[model samples]
Target: MSHQAIYRKFRPKIFDDVLGQEHVTKTLKNQILSDNIAHAYLFSGIRGTGKTSTAKIFARAVNCTNSHDGNPCNECEICKSILDETNMDVIEMDAASNNGVEDIRELRDKVKFLPVKSKYKVYIIDEVHMLSKGAFNALLKTLEEPPEHLLFILATTEPQKIPATILSRCQRFDLKRIKSSVIVENMEKICQEINVKYDEKALKLIAANSEGAMRDALSILDRCVSFNNEEVDYETVINLLGTVNYQVVMEAASSLMDKSIEKTMILVDDILNSGKELSFFLDELIICFRNMLIIKTTNSTDNLMRVSEDEAEALKNASSKISVDEIVNYIEDLSTAQLECKRSLNPRVLLETKLIKMLHGVNHTDIETLTKRIEELENIIKSGNVPVARQSAKAAPSRQTAVHNDFPAQETRKTVVSEHAVKQETSHDTSNSVQEPRNFENKSDEAIFNAIINGWQAILKKVRSENAGLQAIIRESKLTEVVNKKAVFEFDPKFTFHINAANQPKNRQKFKDVISSFVNDNCEVEFISKREKEEKSNKPKQTIEDIYEDLKNEFGEEIVEFKQED
Candidate 1:
């Protein structure tokens, strides 16, 4: 006899043999026991989940002359006929190939005829979603009210594509993807039965790569066995799948956490030179990061992190060195790279680029990254090393502020000034801008403005929770200055819609309420155009040391301290 693939050779002949789908099989057996079988059935799930196998078994069970516990006795003539494909009563059709209106019409005409040898004729249509609209419509009448001697079993990976009219007339059963542990156990049994030497870890690696598909797992196992029929081990499986081992994965993750760019790149180079696929390695990297995150968050490995004790310990140690936020960002970057890797011709470069980015630094624009930076600054302040600017005679002095005589009071105004229009609108000399006059000498006002600037991200987060639309609009506006009880926001002239949106009566009030809660004062909000802001740009830019000194002054010595070296 010719060699048959393991998936086909070890195909489940009975419902009891189907793995990880007890909820479906048990109900089916009960239906058989009660003799309450439906005329039409719909089986749906991902591939290799045993939809067609279950359909075939159920068809045989209902026709078997000698049956036990809702199972078919293959010894019986009718059962053997169906198994051998000689029986005309049980017809299996691949709807993917025969999905035309005429095909369903042919089947509809056949439903009226009685079974040749069996009690009922069963029609199993796999990939039923591939049927055309006209084909589905043609199948509807026959499916809805088929002859008592006819049975229709429809299977599809996507049930949503099936017409509701066709779905309503059938008994639907959604099969689940088989678990990895179950696949491993079954594969181990196959190895023993075939007298092949194997490593338990090798079976697990295969199972993990199979992604909860029994047929995929078996197919992978077949290739591994073919490569070395005498034995299957971790090294063989890893090489066959083009994926790195757990040790390499852990080491790569460690290098990333340590920010050792050279070491990580060398590892990537070595893996590439060894003919390992970058995409598979990327997948391993993602799983490795996910496991570490799980360990970091839950502090437990039971049923979560699918690794050995040593691997779990390594993950725990590595996870300790990184924060949850950083790990999440790394996962996000790697996941995005993974998606792009499929389309890129040079996946190696893409993979290396993402790894380098994760190592270099976090995106400062991200809210979590900004929050982390603020926390780091606070820690520096508490440590008493806040920098102080050195005074030099030649250095420019702080500019003065001349109050605007026409400043509006108690009401918010939108200033849509252009470069040419600024002179006419301000109506005052701007060598010393008027916007800063109210807070120029009052250190308390300066402190309040600084405090709001530092807590800007938090305010945005609060606004996001309450009103996402408002937060989105105002996020583009910079809090340039806070004078009196009013807060001024500067928006890019192109984003004038943002200014207009924030100026609305209801949105403006909601934003005012949020800002008031943050500053512990009833604050009025104002939006200004970028052109108007530029007109008041006479303030001296602060040096790095000067900014640190301001932070120290605002947070106090206990929270922010700085030192200067001569």
Candidate 2:
């Protein structure tokens, strides 16, 4: 006999043999036992989740002559014929290849007749979503009112593409992706049955790489076995999949956590030299980081990493050195780099640049350190110990009362300003006459706007130095004005790229923070086109309570719980 792939060879012949789909199996079994079978059934989920296998098993179980407990007896003639694909009543069609209206019409015409021999005439259509619109319309009426003896089972990975009319007629059962732990357990059982020497770590690597697909995991295991001649090890599996070594990923993460760019780059270089794909390495790193995050945040191991207990403990230990925010940032960067690597002509260059950025990005600044520094500055400012030169100078009388002359209650404002100026100037000997008059006339608007423009220019320079594409777009952007604590930025129609970039929540928040720090105030920043009107009515005007409620809904209800802050 020719060699058969593991996935095909080990296809579930009975519902009990299906792994990681107990919900599906149990429900189908009860339906069969209670004689509540639907005329048309639709099975949907991610690929390799046993949608087709379950359909076949259902066909056999319903038609088997000598069936017990909702399971088919493989020894029966009907079961054997279906298994061999020679059953006259059970017809399997690939809708992907035969998707015309005529084909569906033919099936619809045939459904009016009774089964030739079996108890039920089963039509299994794989990838049913590929059927044409006319074909779907043709199938709709027949599927809704098929004969008592006729049954239809539609399977598709992309069920969303299927029209709602057809979907409403059939009973839908969404099969879930098989979990990694289930995949690992099943692989171990298969290895024991085949008498192959395999390590648990090798099984783990296969499961993780499978991405919750049982068939893919088994197929990978089949290749590993073929290469090693029945003795599968972790190194052999890694090499066969062209995956980065787990140790290498760990070392890279450790170096990043330690802020050792040199060590991380060396590890990256070694992986590249070995000809492993940078995209694949990034995917593996994401999984590694995900595992670390799970360990750090959750005390339970229910959905934790599907590795061995020892490996899980090791990940737990490693996760202790990094904060949750750092992990989130690292994953975000790697995920973005992975997406970019897919489109770049030189993936290696993109990968290297991203690694360098991850190792040295300003986002990596420790939050605890920043908070401590801010607290120290606040303490110094509170204690009246700041340098005398850093204090503000007094405002001149002309600039102070100029605005009041146009109104009437100007003396009161001037008196208040003079008192503040006296107190502020008493603490410092800085030049009060130089810029104080101009600032008093404008009341700090010009200074704030200049500071905002300077800060944005600096950020643009940094972005340009790192990413040329971003630089090309932001170069044409301009800062228009800062009014009512809102920084209004403008970009030309020729350079509309920053509009999309600024709309991203992360980028928007970063820009807002930078502008706020530059202006030295709790100001909001908004990016708008030059032609856009700054209508107060059109603004996103909302009370603080309303904003808090919206944020609570976005983040989670727990974020808004009342708490007394010290």
TM-score of each: 0.68, 0.69
- For model 2, the stretches where C-alpha displacement exceeds 4 angstroms are 1-4, 364-369, 388-566
Give per-residue CA lDDT, model 2, range 78-117, as digits (tens).
Answer: 9999999888899999999999999999988888888888
- Kindly list the per-residue Cα lDDT of model 1 for residues 470-521, writing each as its tens digit: 9999899988666544578889999978889987756767777677667766
- Whole-model alpha-carbon lDDT for candidate 1: 0.76
lDDT of each: 0.76, 0.73
Cα misplacement distance, residue 545 of candidate 2 (Å): 33
User: Candidate 1 at residue 238, lDDT?
Assistant: 89
State model 2's lDDT.
0.73
Show pairs that collide, candidate 2.
Answer: none
- Model 2 poorest 10 in a row by lDDT: 414-423
